[model samples]
Target chain A: MNLIPVKTRILQKNENLFLFFIEYAEKNINRVIQENSVLVISSKIVAVSQNRIMNILDIENKESVELFRKAVIDEADEILVDKNKFFLTVKNGVVIANAGIDKSNSKTGEIILWPENIQEFADIFSEKIKKKYALKNFGVVISDSRVTMRRRGTVGVALNWSGFWGVKDERGTKDLFGRKLEVSTVNIADNLVSAAEILMGQAAECIPFVIIQNLDSGLFTNIQQTHKSAEISQEEDLFQISSN
Target chain B: MNLIPVKTRILQKNENLFLFFIEYAEKNINRVIQENSVLVISSKIVAVSQNRIMNILDIENKESVELFRKAVIDEADEILVDKNKFFLTVKNGVVIANAGIDKSNSKTGEIILWPENIQEFADIFSEKIKKKYALKNFGVVISDSRVTMRRRGTVGVALNWSGFWGVKDERGTKDLFGRKLEVSTVNIADNLVSAAEILMGQAAECIPFVIIQNLDSGLFTNIQQTHKSAEISQEEDLFQISSN
Candidate 1:
């Protein structure tokens, strides 16, 4: 599989994402959109398209540290760690620092919020691409850059997905040695999102749109059933239990 | 950037890893081995080459679950969660399930251990490749599949890396609006490993090696300075503190 980058100029807040994708697809004449291709899009672009940006200067007065903490608590679903230096919080099923509100890469004194209606917009974007490209089996994954709990730096995470079956259940399947496989469900969406980051990049790469071509046929599905393994409940989360 | 798969036949226990890479590189004439290109390898192959397979029958009787738990505890540096159904543990600095001992891809009744001398062997591999390809700047990353704390499914993690600088420090860098950036160190090796999985695959694809070409000049370094962000102390860990 090859991760083809569709280069675009810097996207401003509330830009038309669907229009940008179409324009780039039209301009990249050398790269053809094939059937069974998965278009991995950075969620930052989606968030930007939805105008999910906030001006940090508008709030917090001059006490940036205290107000930022208060803002995080308000936005977060649950606060996991409340250290004097930083806090780890849970938001929209993912445990993130500061409720996923990012300040880097945004306008000065402003923060970028995650897209509000992720799945709805992903479905609409998927439909627009399918119609325009005339492809039967295609997948759209909205990816965001996230830092892992114990690991440093940022890797791509699938915030929402459409037009693909996200999980590959290998519970009953046999391994190479014919041993019954256990805990073998493959998280296809997030891995694809991580692959998209090869082109999207963390800094000012400005190439948020990534096209992943030549995926297996079984990977495609409608938006309703695409996010099955995106989030897991806290009770069933071993890592969460271990943390507490 | 592009991820190109290097195909090889199913490798048996204690197979020569260096030989396999050299032979595969020789056969794939279509793809050029460029300078500053990264060779992303799955850690499983490295462990296999190191004769790290352990037969379950040799260790314990018919009580498979009990024996596996014992093995995991023995292998782990610290056990984080010891639930009846599962065990999440930390080994060598990273928190992982079952101490990262994998069973699915190995022979029947056998489990594969992570490479004992990961960094040392990675350096050797990097040196061998640089000489063979006559490349001034190149990188080698040994990658493994890992599940996140809250998220479902497996994503690629960089087990060890060599022949390149692994972290991109952007702590004092300016964002788009010239605001000072924080937590801006990009885990370059891990992201590259995740991108390699776009072709290396999780199952019996037998494509253990992936070649990435056309990286920035600043990314490459000597093996002595390759791995910088592989481990973190528990006290300074925000995620660990949250768990406490």
Candidate 2:
């Protein structure tokens, strides 16, 4: 697998994401965007396309920090960390800092919020792009980066995906010695999101779009056109903190 | 980055891992292993090198479940979940299932333990391979795979890295608008490990080693040869469950 980062000019709020992609990748990606390729765009860009951005002060008539508190409470399904420093909260069934309301790479005092309806948009974008390129097989992943517990620096999580299956159920699959494999599924897009996250720097690199070429063609769904991510309950999540 | 999975015959217990790599790659990789490239090897292989494999029945001469329970208690820094389904435990200050004790992809009735001394082994292995190729700069990553919370499929984690810095501290860096970036650092090796993980499957593919070629040369350390991964305490962790 090869992670190819595409540099683009800063995306404006409410810009048509498909048109914007063509404007930047039109002549460049035709030759490189082949079947079995995955197009990874940062969740920040998806939020920008949905106009889910606002000045921190505009969240409410209060200081930036206080306004951020209100916003996190509103966006979060459950607020993990209440206040003081940044807020640690649960949004859309995932744990992320400050509800994925990013302040970096934006105008000072402005914060970009995560897109509300993710899977629906991912499906639409994948359809439009595949139709434009006339490709039969392709995948799209909207990715977000977060700080993992007890791990330094940050790691990536796929917020949502479209055009392919997210996980491969290998529950009854046999191991080398014909014993049933313990781990059930293979997360096809999660690994790809991490690879692309390296190139999609959070600061001034302006590389929010990445093209992952040459992933195993087998991982791509048989043109199923699904726009969903796997849902795991807290009971199934081994890493969940019981405090929630 | 191109993750080229190298298929080798199943590594035997107590086998010298460096020798095994050269035996499989000596004639093939010299031309392709250039400066500023990283080689990712499975932690399972690292354990096999350290002779960490044992029959589940061997521990205290008990049943496999009782043996594994004893092993988890022995290996874990803290036991998160005692028993019932599988042990969710903390090892070396990170949350993992069964103390990173893997039973899949191994011989029938056998279990593989994570190498006891990881950073030391990563440094030595990287140095030996670099010397064999006579290259100035090369990195090695001892990798493990685990399921992320609420995320389907397992993601790769870098147990330890050698010949390069693991995380880039960008705390003081400025974003696009010259505002200080919110996130302090970027986890460099974490992303590369994920790229390599997809090719290094846990089943009969027998691809435990992957050569990650064309990672940005700038990410490689300037020959400091440090082998420590950054540490994060629970208080500093945003996602930490208070229950821990």
Candidate 3:
């Protein structure tokens, strides 16, 4: 696998997503879009391109120091942890810090919310990229930076993916000794995003896009199956089971 | 960043770690060991090389369907969840399913435990690799597959790392609007492991080793800091705060 970070100008608010991609491709002259390649776009860029941004001053009330609180609540499906410093919210069935509302890299007093209908946007973006590149097989993953439950530091996770299978199930498959393997599904999309982050720095790098080439094409035969396969039920959640 | 899976013969029990790496390098003829490169080794391989294998038959008694129950108890630091179908345990300050004792890929009726003193092994491995390649700066990360709190499927996480800073701290750093960024540490090692998993398949594919080149050498100047920086305290944990 080869990962090449696509460095572009600091994307302006409401920048055309297609033009941004074109500019990135033109600047990084060596990176030719290949068949069966995966392109990773930061969720912040997606939100910025869609103009899904908010100003802190707009949401603030005269009496409260909780300036960003209202925005977090408005976007969250469930507010799991409301601490003095941060809020862990469930949005679109994913629990994330600050509801995945990025404050850094935003214009002064402004913040970037997650792109509305992320899955749909990813589907459309994938279609456009496929058409532009004229590739038979492609993968597009929208990525968000996040911290894990017990681990320190943030890594990238796949918020939405299109054009390929995102998860690989190895259940009912035999191990080396022929014993049945259980609970062996792999999150292929999230893993790809993690790799892409090595090049995409947290701040000031302006490399919001990444191109990943040489992925196996066989796993992406049914893109719809990838979306469904990556999701887990509440009962199967290991942390939830332990919390109970 | 270019990732190439170093395919080698299925590692045998009690295999010499150094010999195993040599085999991997020889097999992947094109992937030269570059300076400032990172090598990712799966935790399973480390455990197997360390001879940390246990037969389930050895732990079970004549009575009680203690299938893997005894092994889980023996390996866990704290058994958080022990239900009919699964067990979530905290071992070595990390919460993981089944105490990170892998059953799949082991011999029939046998399982592989995490390598004893993973950090120490990684340090030694890094030193050896650096000497062999004659590189002043190198990175070695030992990784394990894990599922997140609410997310489906497994992604790679860093168990231990050496030769480079694994965490990038952005605390107190200014954002684009000059606002101080807090709670923004980045997991550099975990992201690398996640990318390495692209080539390292869950089963059948014997590509357990990966080489990542073209990383910034400045991050590796102080290797001692890398080990200490990645460890998070219980009080600072987001999940712990909510659980309390």
Candidate 4:
């Protein structure tokens, strides 16, 4: 599969990402995304667009700030605390530090968290793009950078998705030798999002979005779109270990 | 990205996998891959083929067997000690088990360990296949099913590989916005082998091999084939916790 990284302007806090895409599309800025291509946006941008910002300073006490810092550390994997008050995870995974908190592109001193309603945001964005372009089979994936335990660095993971098949195949398909397979379906959307994240760097370039095309359309029939709560279980979650 | 499971007739003790492949590839095989293709073979077949068999009954005392068993457990993530004699661990990143033993595929009452010189075997098999098929860029990977510390079931991992690029791209290229990528290059051969292993299931079918093609060819230009010694470091290896 060919990976193309889209170059877009830095997203300002409180700015609607969908509106930004609509504006770009109207200006003929991103024509590479054809009628039925998929657009993958970072969850940070989605969260910013949805105004999901929480500031540690606004929290009443030092105890709460400390607890939140520990939670962010545990859930995010890698982190950097800046200026004694701002905690950022850098590419380490926690997008809370100054790296994640924005003042230049955001309201003053207001730390922006991820979008509140990511699934709804993805659905609305996908619907708007489809309606405006008259395109069928278009998709939108709200992604976030995450690090797996024992592995270093981060890879983009899908937080919410719409207009695409979330999973492909099912267990019990016959192998080439005719033996039935069990428990072998793949998470196609997650894999595609991971592939797309190769182009969305964490720092510097600020290309927080990507438009993917020429994907195998046959893999887009059984889409499973859900909110973050549905995808993350409190128990059996590795990220929750340090948080608690 | 389509996966096809391979099946082989049940192998007897002292069965040579290289010879087996030579005979198997001769019939029904359409093409012996020339470039950007990999062959996945079971490490058990390699050990049995190379005549690396042992017997626990031959040991003088229970203490010796117990010590060996403990070492196996310590080194491996999961331990399956059947009948208190035979041992197995599905896929846990490392390739050794029973401390790498075999009895079902070996002579009665005898257990086989992994091959002594797997890279040598791979080199020879690679040469033979190339000469026979008049091909240029194929690879042979001896794999074993292993289980991890916290994970369940068996996953295939490459024990040894030859005639193929071992690790693909190191992250040095800039993203579209000119941000330098760090630590992003992946072990492409290992991931591809793992992908193939999901299809090459154990039990019943006895599918010991698979052929993978259509991988990106750019990966081969800077091939980085590694040996077992390179995989382990005496200084930092935690599994060397106990002295044998």
Complex DockQ per candidate: 0.57, 0.67, 0.63, 0.08
Which lDDT tens digits does candidate 1 get at residues B1-244?
6667898877777778999888887797464578878999887888888888777752235576677777788888887777754677777666677788887788767788888888888888888988987889988888887777677777778877888877667788676666667776667787888777656655666788988887777888873853447565565456763333
Q: What share of the true interface contacts does each candidate keep?
A: 0.59, 0.72, 0.66, 0.01
Better of 1 and 4 by TM-score: 1
Model 2 per-residue lDDT at B152: 63
In candidate 1, which residue pairs get closer than 3 Å at backbone N, Cα or C atoms, i.e. clash? Answer: A56-A109, A243-B243
Candidate 4 wrong stretches, greater than 4 Å: A1-244, B1-4, B53-112, B221-224, B228-244
Model 1 agreement with the true structure over A1-244: per-residue lDDT tens digits: 6667888887876778888887887797465587888888876778888887766673336666666666777788887777743667777666677777776787766777777777787788888878887888887878876667566677777877888877666677665555667777667777788777656656666787888877778778763754546676666567854333
The sequence of per-residue lDDT tens digits that candidate 3 reaches over residues B1-244 is: 7887888877887779788788768767664688878999999888888889887663234422375777788888887767744777777656678889887888766778888888888888888988887889888888888877677778888888888888888788776556677567888888998889878877767777898888877667544634456668767776753321
Residue lDDT tens for model 3, A94-184: 6688889887788766778999877888887778877887878987888888777767888888888888878777888776666778678
TM-score-better candidate, 1 vs 3: 3
Off by over 4 Å in 1: A58-61, A226-228, A234-236, A241-244, B58-62, B226-228, B241-244
Ranking by TM-score: 3, 2, 1, 4
lDDT of 1 at A91: 72
Clashing pairs in 3: none
- Candidates ranked, most accurate by DockQ first: 2, 3, 1, 4
Q: In model 2 chain B, where is the ten-residue run with the lowest total lDDT?
A: B221-230
- Residue B105 CA displacement from its true place in model 3, Å: 0.5
Indicate whether candidate 2 or candidate 4 has the larger TM-score.
Answer: 2
